[model samples]
Target: MTNLKLHIDYPHDIPIDAFQWTPETTLEPFHTHTSLEIGCCISGSGVFYFEQKCYTVRPGDIFIVNQTELHIAQSDEVDPSTFIFINFDPSILLLEDEKLLLPYSYQSEKFQNHIPAETSLACQLQPRIMTIHEELSQQDVGYLSRARSILIDISVLLLRNYIGSISSEQWRRMNHSYRELRQMLEFVHRHFGSNIQLADVAQTVGWSQARTSRLFREYTGKSLRDYLAQLRLSEVKKRLVTTDDLIANICFDCGFQSMASFYRAFHANTGTSPKEYREMNGLSEDFEKLGDANEKSK
Candidate 1:
């Protein structure tokens, strides 16, 4: 019998979401508020598409995606693909005094530029990912705290592994690129819901618009514009699930220019219209509240 795995936990306040998917299903293209992602394959095999490169993954395999990289997952064979995804805000690793103790320090250098398929780091990370998955599966309080600790441990392991591999000069070069990328990412996160232009983003990162476009595409496998659009749509979905804002208001709030554009993009990305998507997802109450709020404000 083929065993496929798909599990999701919608925890409140953390802005992180976890889910599992198997060969029988495919997940839509999605981005997250969390800048770092760690996933492990427990059984079967699959492929992960990131910034146009396809990484073949299997049991006992793991991959780390830097923040805001456009990615999708798919199963490779009839065997069910079982894996666990751990997502978290990058700020969790940026505590003032502890900032230097992170993998992010190795930025554009060999460590950041190359993604080793099966490293000693992978061996260290597997247990941490597994432990977190177990804790999340539990129906206990403080699960969020437990998850956070595991994530921090994983980050430390990555930093240590990276430091062992390169010279200070290499580290310095990579760190420079890493810093620029981090800044670029911060700008996107902060202003995704505004009238952001590609040239503006380039200027913010101190790179020419063409160079910035190439680097972003190289790192994330999607154009800057498309990535921002995905981020906006993701924010809109989160609001739809958690707030009572009108669809039109949510659309504008998410930086969409008009209801028509929002509808087209939403449907193209999510396979459903905003109104119908909300209704189908048992958000009828939210739909009604949005209508009521609009009428009241008039």
Candidate 2:
């Protein structure tokens, strides 16, 4: 399967993005991104694949994916599967309550991605997710605020379910990891454009470099150095879609000190040069409608 790290650019001033997703005729490559995604299967039956596990999904089932897992969903040939996906930055609600992110911070190997339709949580989540899509599409007064409130409520239910499923010892360990993960993510977001190193990140959590790297890789699926590069490349793609900045300038700003290295990484990961990616995804014509950039992925 292909390894594609999807770039999700949240529209300006809007933290949550919700949309209906119907699997296409062609297969979608296994992929992951920094954005936390929750998908509700609305119709038909199909298979959802993670790194090594596959779950059969039916109507009203819920799937949660964090930055750790590489995953995709495919509909059966005879009956198409359709879903509504809610995506947002992990930071969107971090400032409110770090525990709200606990559900998404699950260890991929042990986490349960699919919540069966028969469960109360699954039934509750499906309607709330649809409400999010409606709020986003309508954009009524205080829509975003209402949407975030709904998100928090949804997160709370997820948290309660997760809390009920794990032991107290596991909760204690995950709680510590959650705070550290948020710290690392925030620090990287602030200084990813600079010459930061593993030691610097370790300093944030006051842990040895080795231990820090181990935990980070365990949860994020990449080493700290590689994860930093991943963030840089994501920033590069976002700028390419939304701005008119020169390619070299964008590369350097995102912390790729060497233009050649940036170009090589870009080509290797995306199968397209920066120029081609931009040309295909650029919203230069209608800059204000920046939401168009996300259409490329659909």
Candidate 3:
């Protein structure tokens, strides 16, 4: 299956990020991130658009998204879904187990992306995940260490229950494939802000244009152009929220060839114009902070 190439530059200070939210009434655009994400449905029902299929999600249902796996979430608007998400770098788990879970996680056939409530493991995992959420929210002095411990326990459980060991050759193949994928993703990140094309990416990775395009689509589940558009949109979104740049300027700065295309693409991908998005996020006050600080300096 083609996976979406999602890049998340996580903050160094905190290697893991966790949160719970009731998705506001809309279908999230196709997206991916660098952190491996574990999600549990807290209430209501929803569907996760993943791996070119839809997986129904209900209360207590658990889903896993590997780093750079393209996916989207849509709640049943009438019922609405609340879900808790825990996103962490695999390296963070190695603090306890130096080897990490890489070996087990690579066992493709045994590893699963979704676990329904009917499963025995899911029954056991729901409560533990909730407890971890509680520990994080309360932040009772040693909560950070406590939270990490719980996370490690969860990782171990998943490895034991769902993953299987691979043979030497299989392990070597999977490792090499994933390393190449990461390099391709890094190339996309480095050049997305410029006039990067599929041909350019293919040449950079030492492949024919046709071969590169096909592989990119197969692995990412989206076209190279579409991924580039999403990447540009993300940058535009960031600039909209954090800076006072003009909309047209932000569009060009992020690599859109013209304002007409930018507006069309932004609205199609985000469901809102750039002006409306800024207002919806309520970041104008955040943008004003710089001016306020400057005035105080005077």
Best prediction by TM-score: 2
lDDT of 2 by residue, 1-298 (tens): 7789876756534446988888764668899886788999989878899888899979999999897689989898888899999988666656557788778877788899989999988989988999998999898867888888898999999998988767788778877877887787688779999999999999998889898888776545457787777778888998998789999999999999898999999997788999999999786566645557667657
lDDT per residue, candidate 3, 1-298, as tens digits? Answer: 3445565543212345578977656775677665677788989987877646678879989887775456777888888888888777654553345333453344333445788988987888788788777877776756767777888888877866643455666656765655555567678877777898877787776788887777666444457897678678878887887777899889887899988999999898678999999878645565679879999999
Candidate 1 ranges beyond 4 A from true positions: 1-124, 131-153, 280-298
Rank candidates, lDDT, best first.
2, 3, 1
lDDT (C-alpha) at residue 241 in model 2: 87
**Colliding residue pairs in candidate 1:** 51-220, 51-221, 108-174, 109-174
Which pairs of residues collide in model 2?
A: none
Candidate 3 stretches with Cα past 4 Å from truth are 1-164, 282-298
TM-score of structure candidate 3:
0.52
TM-score of each: 0.55, 0.63, 0.52
- lDDT for residue 258 in candidate 2, whole number 0-100: 97
Please report the TM-score between candidate 1 and the true structure: 0.55
Cα lDDT of model 1 by residue, 119-198, tens digit: 77677778778777777777366776777777777776777666766677767776677567667767887888898998
